[model samples]
Target: MLNIPLWKRVVIVGLVALGLLFAMPNAFYSRVEGHNDAVAAIEGGAESPELTAMEGAWPGWLPSSLVNLGLDLRGGAHLLAEVHLEDVYASRIDALWPEVRDALRDQRATVGTIRQQNSAPGELRVRISNPEGIAAAVQAVQALAQPIVSLTGVGERDLAVRSEGADVVVTLSEAEQLATDQRTMQQTLEIIRRRVDEVGTREPTIQRQGNDRVLIQVPGIGSAEELKALIGTTAQLTFHPVVSQTRDGSQDPGGRNVIYPDLEDPELFYILERTPVVTGEELTDAQPSFDQNGLPAVNFRFNVSGARKFGDYTAENIGSPFAIVLDGEVISAPVIRDHIPGGSGIISGNFTVEESTQLAVLLRAGALPAELTFLEERTIGPELGQDSIDAGKIACIVAFAGVLVFMALSYGWFGILANIALILNVGMIFGLLSMIGATLTLPGIAGIVLTIGMAVDANVLIFERIREELKSAKGPARAIELGYERAQSAIVDANITTFLTAVILFVMGSGPVRGFAVTLGLGILTSVFTAIFVTRLMVVIWMERRRPKTIEV
Candidate 1:
């Protein structure tokens, strides 16, 4: 056993205590409203009473803030969405086959015609006019197939392909084809989470489900409809010149007339057709700001390429009004007086602060790859979270008490030392969690409970080994030393295997499951340290001080 200095032990314990002290306010007593109010008061050129109180009441410890509570423990909605791979495949097939037909026509390879037939769930059959260039056509199709997960021959000439699960498939599409698949879905979910977080929603859980699915749980979010609207639509934005038709089919009396294409019904328009000069993708940054006219608007800056494009488009199209379209709706039409060279422009519409902010957020998140469909949604209430916390606390208390009683009854005085180490182990877990700002889910609480039970397994092994050594006529101190030494291998082997499984789970799992795995893994590490090192240290000190002739086991 490596002998740790007493001063080193003091420092470790002192640091743990200090961490707990600093974390208390953020963990249990810090009020969100109070923090906000303090900031607002200070901003308004007034002294904040709350700030003064906070300063006075501040605990003197390193700020190890409380673990972030997860949605499951804090009551939040759980959502599961399956990606419409079928729709994506169909769209890809439709788009690609047309290009294929055009290429074939250009090559003059087709002696007859081309047709598409459905083979399997995600398989496509392309009938060609001539069998002469069929190999070349298949090779051409294979080039496009590179972006897809895997392409295999269904029969003789038919091709069968499907995305490889979720992550791999999404990454392949996003990186290779610029096709939005699983990656798009996952990014959309993350953006939505950021948006909700900006709105001060606490402990929201957003994660990717299977391959094409997303699971989101927003705790304490009352505005489900608004959130759905925010998350479900593709907020594609574009700037187009207003095309006007006069009474003579040339020009209208109005300066410039603009039309918007209806998203649902392409045949209809909110306005007449206008060619787009620029799209939102070129935007580098957007923020809510007041325009020169003192109207709430979204001020945006474009990249160099976008600036050049916008400058060229506007310089040529002077006196023509350009309509800013968002999600297929005309938001504003501003006449170009001078060319915008720097790529900075203001979207001045009649907007409230909230509307302007939301618009800015939408612009920042960029356009969604495809239209989104919300298949499932749920909202968890704070009361549910409170209930979970209550239940978890009860379980933890029961487990801890049960472990304590079992240890004391089984091993007498030495068991008491193990129980003390167990208490420290719990403290160390919380301390580490607070220090790292880990989010605690219901599964995390269960992990702690399980740790409590498993922690004793180490001590139990050591105690059993000591009993065996005593039976072999070993002296008290010698038996104690041999017991810990012999049991070390078994204890390490068991914990290491469990730790490996936890690592795997943490890597592969999502959201709450990952939280559970993280806690379990961390607990195992801390338990090993406290159970073996701490317990051994205590036993050594006790033995040196008391020099007991026999140890009760």
Candidate 2:
């Protein structure tokens, strides 16, 4: 009665062989990882004899994918950063100044010369010489308000314009503020990812935490401080028109201009327009290079739109000084000697080679929307991760040995079949992890250990059911069939519930908890297949060959 079709037999054997073959690379993890990296570099257009030889060391047809170790299992840096969303609000209001001034100017007969007033960061306030026209000024500014294009901001306006005493105040509506915050966070996450990726670190975890936070984990990084230094720079690069050069700090430059001291010469100051001619977001490329004087500098190219704007500005204001501001400080002020037609230009300053390179990287990665406040930072040492791996390996071996010995003493040869299936189950788990490129953590190791016990528990249940059926009038073959049939419902129900729990954990938890859920969920699947199908096939084959008349439980 126990028989397997030829196709079914082939399928079972093929799966086991394929799993082992794919999982083989993990045995030589470092070598395989090196091979993979070398291959990637070649694919990325890097040509080197050493990399070619390294790629040749591994077989071309074989799968080179390996399970990535998580921050807990590999030395890394972990950072929790809170984005300063309010910073965007101030900039948003500052940006609206030009439009507001234009709109008020068009209605000059009603609202006389308009002047901006000092207000809160997110609030925009304006005063007109003709206080009687305050109502008209408010109406003019309100014309600029548009409907917020967000699901939660349905039917709500983007800006809230109001008349306060003799001044008109404008602020972002609640719905608009929410939408802006979301966009700011998304932009911040993207820029951070780009910056981290530029360094070519492997398998870095960059994820949004809450509404205004981001969590970053990078493996093999030296410390949290190093990671922070790499990504923490605001890198707000802006180009503004220089009004005048001055030594006096107390003198008022104008309403829309600002006076910033030179980085190299503190006594020297440049009064520059607040609004930028172009921002770093329009940069297409930035590279560290030398200036005409052989000084360290960064050369940048702009996108089509940025180039046109910059080209026009330089053409109209020949010989006028243009200030390059970095994070609110004037880095360089260079006078436009000619109408530069091309989008490419150089930024020269008192910079070392390293500073120039760093600046270039930042410019290429784009500027962050808002500054990030470090809420938490931690460095995980490689030594500690190694110790965890060592302990986990010991625990796994101990659990595996105990299960094998117990199953062998209790069920004899049938237990031997289950043990074989258990070994294959573990292999398949690794194989799946490799194929999917899942990250392995210390918690994942614990999940694997727990799976060893569960794998045998199914066999124990089936074997006990056989022992009970043997007491009836049925023979060995009939009793075995009945035992498996009776155990099916119980095994399926138990594993299904546990699998669902694992899914829930994965969805609700973060970091290590999710890692544990991954292994636990995959273990359930592999163990179920091994216990129900693979073990049954092995038992059927053995029985067909031996054809035992009577069998002991």
Model 1 weakest 10-residue run by lDDT: 163-172
For residues 25-68, could you state the per-residue lDDT of candidate 1 as single tens digits?
A: 45443553345445545666767566756444533343525567
Stretches > 4 Å off in candidate 2: 45-49, 247-254, 294-296
For each candidate, give its TM-score against the true structure: 0.75, 0.95
The segments of candidate 1 whose C-alpha lies over 4 angstroms from its true place after superposition are: 1-57, 81-183, 186-190, 200-203, 245-275
Per-candidate RMSD, Å: 8.1, 2.0
Clashes of each: 10, 0
Per-residue lDDT value at 204 in model 1? 71
- CA lDDT, every prediction? 0.69, 0.90
- Record all residue pairs in model 1 with backbone atoms less than 3 Å apart, i.e. clashing: 74-385, 76-380, 77-378, 77-380, 83-212, 166-211, 246-251, 246-252, 259-271, 259-272
Best by TM-score: 2
